[model samples]
Target: MDRTTDIIIIKSIDQLPSVDEIKSISRERALKLVFKENINRQREEIGQYLDDTLSGFLVLIHKIDPELNIVKLITDKEIEDHQNFFEQCAKDYRQLGQKLVFMLVDKLDLNLNKDFPLDTFNELKRDERQIGKVAEWKYFVHGFHCGFQNIITGQYIEVPLVFGLEFGDLDPYFFVKFILSSPDYHPLPIPLFEEYADGLRIIEKMVSLGKFEKIHSKIGGHDGTVVTDREKVEIKSNLDLEKIFVNHIKEIEKKSKFNLWKFLGLKK
Candidate 1:
């Protein structure tokens, strides 16, 4: 297929592409998306639902209502090469519905490849690729240390390093070891401390969002903090800590007696 051709087009969740519109597109372009290694009746069934005359390409339309999230596509073969594509599509659709917003295709595919090359998404040239049109086109490569910072200065920091964002999904131990072992890079003494801090930020954000009461309970507490009976019960109950943390932060901010800087060990 010609890279110049706009094979797949992304529309707002509110707007849907009809099966006839998809069928009108060239067959080869459609087939590239839907074809699979092994033919499955399920694919055909989905195709039938989208369009009766699915000659060259099979059309799959998955609509998640309430959020009005929709993914409409035509492929010549089944999606057998990689499972990540379908999973990402589903996740994107779900997120659209939940957030009631549009997000870049890259964010949707964060979990698509556990090991996709970092430069796979980096564009070699401008105008070579359409941003939101192409389905499988590379978009952006997320940096390795997305939120890294210097501890003493509390300033955002970036090491002279570049890693494929795909490693973000794999087990952290392997990635951490790889970074530490690299002869070119001198890793911080307390690498795990940074990871823990990042995790804590996520937990604190969750608490602020009112998603759960106690995140430490679910993750077995922070540092060596013991899980009390109440925390254990909350963990067993699977409570959300996001909102709790949000409220807690608000309360702390309002209290003049509390000193968060000291609590964070940043104050002298």
Candidate 2:
């Protein structure tokens, strides 16, 4: 499943912990302090109120300025003492993410719910067999897979039957072109991509002076066959994902103008 939300509180230089604090303490501590200081208390309940996919989940503060700090929630005695503090940290960040999503929605000028980039399942119309097999996958993409469950049920249709192309034949070039297709043929609105890019620019400004690590996805790319082990790459936009997908979607608008004609059965 292509899912995951990376929530961040972009802190200014002065707003961030002092150099001494960052140097002296663990990342978890620094992040908690950042939350304690910066998060707006009024937005604390936004997570429950929204009650979407991103809610009830902890989006760890993956990175700060000078270094990468992917704070993990440990389940030991040491963590138990600070559990309340850490819970609030997660809540604050979740609310912060919820607020930013709404702000992005407002910027898009779309009447979308609080879940701006709603992660919808394989929601198809009409007949069930019309869709083929439905696969639901939940796995890690940040560093490595720690736990996972990927299941596919129902009549699975061969790729050639659906897209008139072999699954193995699908490559980056083709996928990129397809995703980058004209807005007229695209499933998602092109404006959403534009607004996402705009929001990233704003985040870039917010953490200009602080340690801003390029968003990196734990997931790697496939070159038709093998799933290669990968390093953390610069994935801007919240997830290495948003930045990457946003860039890909935006590029589709720029380079694939002929898609509209093709979709209309016109020679392109």
Candidate 3:
């Protein structure tokens, strides 16, 4: 059988059989699911709670080898008592000598009575701390992952609204375009590519001075794959761009004993 075929997809609670049922599932079967399908090391998991109810659950079981295990539970709005159900699952899995590595597949929707100034744009203004002193930066961007979903047309559709963050004010658009332009895939649309290039130029101009600002892009995807969408770009009072570039070259030299151009068979 194909290796992926041995992996199971659990869509509902009824499929669980019982805590005893999972225990009966061999270690080899369990290991295949966790390593092959579930834990996405790229993006941080986002949880969603509905009207005081948990809507879904995706857990990877790694307490075994030869196979990985995954348990996925999804429910409609009717399941109001999901917390208790999840607690029971935890208890059951504990008995089976397995722990749950939770994953969320949907965005959280919080119902607040008033519209407080909690937006990212607003928070940036209210927080008066200096950019470099903040220590941490949040970069948010959205993009698609092909084959993550299936549409009505029976084609594996792309997941387009994926969003994520990373440390520092990295421009995510540039990072994504760079990755896509690699030998693995084609480049983004011409217009979008130009927009990203222009944004980078503006950032370069700003970096000449001590002031560093965030560049927002609607088409960019986050998850550190795109580093350019950093919430805070370091603004050193005595910034030296040339020195930084030289330092980067030295760092690259440490990793690569020979020049990159020479490695690519290009004449220096």
Candidate 4:
């Protein structure tokens, strides 16, 4: 009944909070936030998987280059076909760019007074007041864009993800959009099916932590009274995680002949 979700806006990489900061709402609200965060975390893993998959494919294609003597007699049509296929795959990634991973957890053991009222949860809708709060929360929570600059197959594909939540008093449902930039932006909705079931598993861990081991805190309410014994929502305040992508790019350079600057033709 009370506003339990903490509103913390993370502006810099240095300010990232630990997983322990999650202490806000209880029951469904807390669970929802956990689900969202799990999805956010998985986006990075999915991006890396895609990068590795694409890179491995490119290595095979590179073998056909004229610089390699093994393919001295390859046909032009064959080369074109490979190029076309790679381009098409990139296009497909662009289309799938906006997809969001949604997953439901089995919480028969939660023992909460009110369950989410669904056996398998795909989406949840709240009223305007709640939706506005959630939108503002997600806007600040999912505002940043971070991922490796994908240059495999001679294509520039960056997974710059953006998240948005919206609801209108007159509308029948709440809307969430996960936007990904494949050099071209695509906006997609969170679906009922799990894009990755691992997200659900992560939330299960969070839920167990939240239910039994939460670090309780106090906050001042509008009446200037301290609200005690409140569950704190995890505050993730740092943008430094984005540096993982930079590190990944460096690793890619170390392992392969992919000279980024040379690829850009700025350096020999």
Best by lDDT: 1
lDDT of each: 0.30, 0.29, 0.28, 0.24
User: What lDDT score goes with residue 239 in model 4?
Assistant: 42
lDDT-best of 3 and 4: 3
lDDT of 4 by residue, 1-268 (tens): 2213333333332333332332222222211111133234443443344334431111111122211000011123332434333233333433332221110112112121111111111122222211111111221111122112233322222222221110000000110012122323322121111212322222233334332122211111101111112322232112432353467568877899767688798976
The sequence of per-residue lDDT tens digits that candidate 3 reaches over residues 5-66 is: 24433343243234444434432232123222343331122111111122122333234342
Candidate 1: Cα lDDT at 268 = 50
In candidate 3, stretches whose alpha carbon ends up further than 4 angstroms from where it belongs are 1-193, 213-268
Off by over 4 Å in 1: 1-28, 31-58, 61-167, 170-268
- Report the Cα lDDT for residue 186, model 4: 27
> Each candidate's TM vs. the true structure?
0.16, 0.20, 0.15, 0.16
How do the residues 128-240 of candidate 2 rate in per-residue lDDT, one tens digit apiece? 32222212422211111011122432111111111101111122222223223323233532211222232233223322422122222233431121011122222222354
Off by over 4 Å in 2: 1-75, 111-268
Root-mean-square deviation of every model: 20.8, 21.1, 24.3, 31.1
Error of 1 at 76 (Å): 14
- The ten-residue window of minimal lDDT in model 1 covers 159-168
